[model samples]
Target: MAFPKELYNAKFVEYIESLKILYLVDDKFKVICDDYCSSKMKTEKYKKKFEKYFQHKLEFENLSKELEDEILIYLIRKG
Candidate 1:
């Protein structure tokens, strides 16, 4: 699957080259990105069952936001 590095904002795709370099050299950053993508996927999955999975969707959305913040911080600092 393609990386979901560009899912958050335009800056991610704009800095694609820098992101590629960081992904190759930073283990923690890679983990954060992967977790962000996973949380996003889970959120989408739960979204289909809005009533039944409301809590699950909300949890994943929060997790996704946190992970996205970490990713942005790393990109700003090291990308």
Candidate 2:
């Protein structure tokens, strides 16, 4: 579940997030992101939401796969 640190950009992030893909497993499965339901910028809404929800930048934050795919990735591929 680890990739090059530099590849973790808004687009890639959004791409993976939208895939509804889950990463890591300790007890069953954990979502990596949020529902990224916004159209503008895609990641901006989540960035702000996470910042407000968790009080931090979305970049440094690790969300559930649901939120990650929903909020980060696009609809074409699964990152």
Candidate 3:
């Protein structure tokens, strides 16, 4: 499958190839990617709406970061 636009994030750029591979073969990784994309989209929407001080936005941002870290760790470990 084609990479989803929602999964395009600067932080994940370096891991694009690995992500694509894992996305196709690993169910858990796919879910993580989906959740990461969702959190990123929500974070952007909240940022636009609240401009930086919204609690929900912060929460989403934090979740996005945590998910990102998880992805990085998983990729590194898989290597």
TM-score of each: 0.49, 0.20, 0.54
Winner by TM-score between candidate 3 and candidate 2 = 3
Which candidate number has the best lDDT?
A: 3
Question: lDDT of candidate 3?
Answer: 0.86
Q: Which run of 10 residues does model 1 get worst, by summed lDDT?
A: 1-10
Best by TM-score: 3
TM-score of 2: 0.20
Candidate 2, 1-79: lDDT as tens digits: 5522433457766666533344333323332222233233467767787768665445346555567777656654554
**How many clashing residue pairs, candidate 3?**
0
Q: How well does candidate 3 score on lDDT at residue 76?
A: 100
Q: Quick one: how many clashes does candidate 2 have?
A: 24
Residue 36 error, candidate 2, Å: 14
Per-residue lDDT of candidate 1, residues 1-79 (tens digit): 3556435557577877777667678889888778877887888777777866887888999999999999999999997
What order do candidates take by TM-score, descending?
3, 1, 2
Decreasing lDDT order of the candidates: 3, 1, 2
lDDT of 3 by residue, 1-79 (tens): 7677876668879998898899999999999888887888898898788865686878999999999999999999999
